[model samples]
Target: MVVEQFLTYLQHEKRYSSHTIQSYKIDLTQFGDFILKTFELSLTEVKYVHVRDFMVTLMDHEVSANSVGRKLSTLRSFYKFLLRENIITASPMALVKAPKVPKKLPVFIEDTKLDLLLDSEELFDDSFPSVRDKLIIETLFGTGMRLAELLALKDADVNFYDSTIRVMGKRSKERIIPIGKGLAEQLKNYISLKTLQNFHNKTTGLIVTDKGADAYPGFIRGIVQRYLAFISTQDKKSPHVLRHSYATSLLNRGADLNAIKELLGHASLAATQVYTHNSVERLKTIYKQAHPKA
Candidate 1:
């Protein structure tokens, strides 16, 4: 009941989005279930020792530090809410420390391979699904829009005259991103074809299933994974790699860091700075291959 009240606080007072609230619910529910099984105590009887023991059990299960840290953070927030409501005398998670997580660089497909993949005749199947899939891949690679932003696009969001797209990103924040001439032309052709097939649904959204419904995340990911699996042998073959490719390609071609930061909708230049490392690694490889120091 206390956890339920805290969840309501997160939903109403914090105004957390549905997706975020669902994640919090899952974390808390899992923690609660674990505590019940381990300590044989009800939610009302949970104490600091129970919380600590649950964390140790998570570690014993070989859960990643980052995952454990996130779960702990969720618990900490829940307990903070309980403390505020006077349901508990003290917060158990206040003294707990989250594990440090290592930062990993984003992985991307090679430019030459990506070019070959895009230019391959297999991509031009002339089927409705094939064309739609190709356009999605091209758009993501060209613009670096997040999956949600790409899915949330409407027919009017793309301005062919201005070569720009209006994307709704994290927290529903909107930004304009420029599309390349080639990608614009492809999108125009796809849109024309889509319209002719009566798949517009009158909803004004651009991306849709064969039945004209808005595409879901699973549907989009399945299409991306299928195409990338055919073209790439990399461990990471998803739409996000296309985003990485977009940023890295821009950096490789002398685009300014600040420009890429704005285009990618990154809150900080530091978040955009990772691509610089990718470019640096590429330059180092080129130098080693072409230099005559040997």
Candidate 2:
């Protein structure tokens, strides 16, 4: 019951996305099961030592540090909630520390490679599916929206005359992302094709499957991976990479950091600041190649 109450708080008060709330639920449930079985205690009764033992069990099972860290984070939030609600007199997670995850720079396809892929007329045919796929790629790179945000996009979200799209971001925050003329035209064409589909019960979501069903997560991921493979050899070809590419591209082109943060709908500037490292790396590479001093 406490878990359900915490989840309700997350959903209504915190406005966490459903997907995120689900993850939190899974994490809490896993911890609850662990504590119940191992320590003969419910979630609120677990102490710091019990949490540490759980961490040891996870490590013993060879779970990746990143995953173990996430589980710990979930416990931290749950315990915090319990404390706030007076369900617990003290917090056990106050003593726990998350593992330090390795810092890897965000990966992005070069702008030239992306341009080559998007501009190649032979790659995207005139058919509805083909055109629709192209628009999906364009929208991801053009707007820097997350996959969930893209899927949540509705027909009413686009303003053709204003060249803007309002996307629902993390915590149900809504922000308007400006679109380029080329992408706007592409969207218009895709909508025209979608309108001609024979499905009687059409979905209002902006992007859909060839069968006119609203696009799901796997469907969108497959589209991004399939298209990105032609241009990038990086192991990660997910939609988030396009989001990174969009941010890096803007930062490289001299867009202000705060502006990039707003466009990407980041909670803070620190998330947007990572793109600056990519730009600095580029400058270093250029200097190495062109400078006279050996």
Candidate 3:
């Protein structure tokens, strides 16, 4: 009952998405089960030792540090919530520390290859599906929006006259992303084609299936993967890769970090700073290849 209430708090007060709330629920439930089975105690009775023991148990099972870290974060949030509500006198998470997660530069498609893919006239056509597919790639690479943001996009969110698209981001935050004239034209054409088809169950969603249903995660992923496979050999090819590509492309071309943060709708400059690593690596390669004195 307490767990359900906490999840409701996450949903209504924290404004966490369904996916995030589900993950938090899973983490909390697993911890609850662990304590009930081993210590025979409820969540309210947990202590710092118990939290540490849970961490050890996770490691013993050979869970990745990244996964363990996320679980610990879930516990921290849960305990914090209990403390705030006076359900618990203190949080057990004060002494708990997350395992270090190795930093990996984000995977991105080279601009040249992406250009080749987008510019190839034979790759896309005027048909609704094809135009829609191309626009999917363009919107992702052009706006740096997340998959969830793209899924939530609606016709009303777009302002062709202003050359911007209003994107609803994490925690219900909203931001306007500028669109290129080319992309705006593409969006105009795609919407025109979609209206002409006039499917029986069409919605106001910006992107839709051939039958006019709102696009889901799998639908968007499949479309992105299918198109990316034609040009990119990278193992990771999703809408997120396009988002990374968008950020990297901007940073490489000297866009300010804070500006990129706002454009990407990142909550902080730290998140936006990762793209600088990509730029630095590229400069190192240039130095190695072109420097006369090695």
Candidate 4:
């Protein structure tokens, strides 16, 4: 009953995305099932030893440390919720340490290849879907929006007068991102054409399927991958890679880190700093090109 209450809190109060809430639910349910079967204890009866035993069992089953750590995190959140509700006297998940995950630079596609992909008219056909597909690639690379954010975009969210797009991001936080002249033009053209194709349906969603239905996750993923393959050999070739390229390009183009953080909708500077790798050389180039004092 309390677990369900926690889920409700995540949905209504926290405004976590459904996918994220589902992950939390799965992790908590797995732990609950383990406790019930192994120790014959309900979640309220769970203690530090029980938590440790669960972690050991997970590890013994060859579950990655990352997964085990996430499960512990779920428990930590659950116990903290219980404590706040006065359902528990003390928290047991505090003692568990998160496993160290290896740090890796974000994988990004080269700018030159993306340039060729978008500019090469021969690569894309003249059909509306083809044009729509090209716009998708540009939108992802031009805007650092995550795939879900892009799919959820509504026609009303695009403000042509101000050259900005409003994005609803994690936790339902809304942020405004400015678009370039070129991208703005592309969006205008795509909307006109998509509207004609979708029975005047394009006004409902910024991006839509062939039948004019709102775009879904798999449709966007496949479209991004299909077009990205033309230009990038990177193993990733996902919308997020385009997002990485967008951030990396801006940082290289003399944009400030905080500005980029706002553009990417990152909640903190630490999250944006990951894009700063190999910045000095790019900064030097941008400085020489544009800095008056240089």
Candidate 5:
């Protein structure tokens, strides 16, 4: 199917994450189903009116503006791909405006709780996998790299002499991030242990499975969730919250915004400013707790 082909295009050429491609596939499939049932037309035959009808149908079904907006975004990307490859001459989503979504503050763990999590060995086991898992949490929380970036790390990417780690961010942009003495020690130990594994099946990735295979996204996310569940009770307990914790912690400590932006590999200051709001919210909560009067 053309949709499957496009998904492959995203996977191979665009470097879109599996999670992102799956969302696109689901959105396109839902829209295609709606088109087939209501208008008896395939995706290629969909018009501007039919696209509008799809939006209306989603609204009638009580989908939120944010969710419907995301689906519209998928349609826009899909139709743009079709138009680009000359499969279609025009895009039905060209005139559509997505619904505005309110910004929500990012959720993050507190510094003290993170301290507790790291200090408590009872939170982790005393095996090879547990040692690797402990370092995974340390790298994610300490370095603030995304899960994809972490999984992509090669041994050569770390410069032990300079105390820095190189990571490839979105759009294939490469950035060098500095690591502290603590993370350097952890990486040294991890590398020594990994070298002891069966040299035949060794993978290039820094994080690996029990069999020494490259760690996939789900595996890493499960690792994140497993450790984070012991400390945090937030509704959202993903790897990104650790990233949020990194950025927010820096902001709360008076670190330069642009410096944090560079550490995070954000393309713009606006993208990094959300941490400022998070910091202010944290301050307000502390004030309410410690102040003599409400």
Candidate 6:
């Protein structure tokens, strides 16, 4: 009942995306089931100790710390709602600590390999689908746009003469990013081809797709995998890695961090700052190899 109410609150008040709301509902439902089994109490009767015990059981089952931490976060938010409604006088999860998650650097292909991947003429073909696929890869690597942003692009969002594309990022915030000359030209050619093929549907905004339909997440992932399978050995070769590669390349070439942050539509410089670590490590490697000291 609590989770049902929470789901409604998230949909109506929070305005979370349907996918996000569904994920929250599943997570909370699992937690509710677990708590019910452990304590044999109704949702209204759950106490702090029961929550803590649930966490212990999760640990006993060897759930990853991150998983436990996320579940705790969901529970905390749920209980916060209860507290606000005066359903509970005290918060049980208020004192609960979240598991520490280690910061992992974004993985990216080297510039040489990226160039090879992008420049492989064999990858490009004269067909509409092939051109569209190539342009999608080019745009993602060119602008570091998130997969969702790329999939949401419209023909109107691109300006070939200005060499820029407007992207709607997280939270529906819009930002315009300049495209490189290479990618700009590629986009122009792709657009011209799209016009010739009559692929642009009036109602759809997606730039690349089969039969004018919008690309779902699975289609995007498959595209990335197919293109990357040739050039990357990295296990995580998704469109996000193309984003990482773009940011890393920009930082390596002396682009300002703040500028990159804005270009990538990151909310804060801190999120953009991680790429600097990758740059620093590269510099250290060069220093060690070039230095005379043994």
User: Which candidate has the top score in lDDT?
Assistant: 3
lDDT of 2 by residue, 94-135 (tens): 878887788779999889999999998889999998998899
Tens digits of per-residue lDDT for model 3 on 1-294? 889999999999999999999999999999999999999999999999998999999999999999999999999989898999999999999988999999999999988988888887999988889999999999999899999999999988999999999999999999999999999998899888988989424698999999999999999999999999998888999999999999999999999999999999999899999889999999999999999974
Task: Tell me which of candidates 1 and 5 scores higher on TM-score.
Answer: 1
lDDT of every model, 2 decimals: 0.85, 0.91, 0.93, 0.87, 0.89, 0.83
Q: Using lDDT as the measure, name the better of candidate 4 and candidate 5.
A: 5
**Deviating ranges (above 4 Å) for candidate 3:** none
* Candidate 5 lDDT, 1-294, residue by residue in tens: 889989999999988777789999999999999999998999988889999999888889889999999999899989998999999999999889877788998899998988888888787675679878889888888889998899889989999999999999886779999998998998988888888876325678888888888898899889889888888888888889999999888889999999999999999999999888988877899999999995
How does candidate 4 fare on TM-score? 0.91
| Cα deviation of 121, candidate 2, in Å | 1.9
Count of backbone collisions in candidate 1: 0
Model 1 agreement with the true structure over 189-287: per-residue lDDT tens digits: 889888988888555778888877788888888888888887688788888999999999999999999999999999899999999999999998999
lDDT of 6 by residue, 85-122 (tens): 88888888877887777788999988898788777879
Query: What clash count goes with each model?
Result: 0, 0, 0, 0, 0, 0
Question: At residue 265, what lDDT does model 3 achieve?
Answer: 92
Q: What TM-score does structure 6 among the candidates reach?
A: 0.90
- For model 5, name the residue pairs that clash: none
Worst 10 residues of 1 by lDDT: 38-47
Candidates sorted by lDDT, best first = 3, 2, 5, 4, 1, 6
Winner on TM-score (2 vs 6)? 2
Off by over 4 Å in 1: 8-15, 40-48, 80-90
Residue-level lDDT tens digits of model 4 in 168-272: 999998999899999999888888887677545444778887777788889999998888888777789888999999999998878999999988989999999
